[model samples]
Target: MAQSRKKAVKKSFDPQEVLDFLRQDELDYPAGAKKFGKDAIPFLSDLIEGTDENLSMKAAYLVGYIDDESVGDVLKKAAEKGSSTIRIAAAYGAQKRSPEVAEAILSRSLEDNNPSVVKFAMKSVSSMKLGKKLKSKIDHISKNFLDDDIKNSAKDLIKKIK
Candidate 1:
């Protein structure tokens, strides 16, 4: 009897193929796309700026996992102007960047009309170590928001910050 050894094969990273995978409606594509890291930033940036909302959202999520600082501005822009889903993805990505940059973008997202965006923003706010000014803003949100859930989230975030 002879024993055979199996060799592992390494596949090259293809930015276009990663983008295509992200564009699909399947749940695993984003995780699969994240393996490209900084190499995927350019393609993800283009997708974030593109017209396809589903692909753009997935790109935004993957861009967040990449550790490139240049993507911050793109994520901020998407968070400000993209659709609610894109905004949520952008917010998630923005939180992975520098806290100073992310804090400002997340703060602005708190004003978004979409509850999901606001909720994501609140979660980001809670996770970070905030300054006096930002804490005051969260306190204000807790006091003034008409939505009970948002108000409670704000209040809970304030408690966590303190």
Candidate 2:
């Protein structure tokens, strides 16, 4: 029967639908785990616009966790355009999924005025741990970190980099 045949067909992929899901999930649980599949990744990618910082940050976080390299550019762009909170989340999230961007994030983290941003940057730098590469970078920017605790933390991190 035509009805039966139609029922057998799968639902069509809709970018808007996935975006709506992301928005709803983000609102419900910003820090909790979310599972947006491949079909939804593009929608999440487009949501990286800085217009809505919270939403953008959530999307970036989800995309980063998805661990898909395709979303790298959008995540990085969100990091650049988003508010400090959003930027920290975006940068931290993106870096976990892609170590290639770690160097750029370290530079931004060093210059960042926000303590939270610097902290996340430090965490990411520690995660990447690229032999001597991080040592020079951390040494050069150690003074920019305003908080002595953070400065000392960065120093401790540099020693562990090797």
Candidate 3:
């Protein structure tokens, strides 16, 4: 009797397939698209900056799975420059980056014209080390933002910061 040895085969995914996976509404870490690693960054960035707000938002969240310093840059940029929906997703996605990177993104989000982005930023800030500048920014929002929800959230965050 002869014994047989089996060799493992590497699985490959088409870029479109990975994009489809990342576009899902509910996803956790170790997402199937993560198998592509940094290679997925460009594709994901395109989607984040793309026309479809829904896909852009999902891509922003999925960017965190790449685990690269550039990933922080991408999320931060999306937080500052993308549409309101993407900014909200970017604010949450940024929590996975380093403290400084996350703070940079959150700071921009705090000033976003969209109240929802500011609210999401406040939520992210609650987990970060609130600095004097951030505390000041939140204080300003608590006092001046036009939206009642964001103003209230900023007030709550100010209490937490103190």
Q: Estimated TM-score per prediction? A: 0.78, 0.70, 0.84
Q: Tell me the RMSD of model 3 versus the true structure.
A: 5.3
Candidate 2 is scored at a TM of 0.70
Best of the candidates, TM-score: 3
Model 2 segments more than 4 A misplaced:
1-35
Whose lDDT is higher: candidate 1's or candidate 2's? 1
lDDT of each: 0.74, 0.63, 0.78
User: Across residues 1-162, which tens digit of lDDT does each residue of candidate 3 receive?
Assistant: 122221111235357776667667677645643666666788889888888888787778778667888888888789878788899988887677788888888888888889888888887888766545489889989999999888988888787767
* True-vs-predicted CA distance for residue 13, candidate 1, Å: 5.5
Clash pairs (backbone) in predicted model 1 = none
The order of the candidates by TM-score, greatest first, is 3, 1, 2
Clashing pairs in 3: none
Q: RMSD in angstroms, all models?
A: 6.7, 5.3, 5.3
Please provide, for model 1 over 16-78, each residue's C-alpha lDDT reduced to its tens digit, 9 standing for 90 to 100. Answer: 778667856765634664567666677778888889888888878877777677778778888
Model 3 stretches astray by more than 4 angstroms: 1-13, 23-25, 131-133
Which 10 residues in a row give candidate 3 its minimum summed lDDT?
1-10
- Candidate 1 at 5: error in angstroms? 30
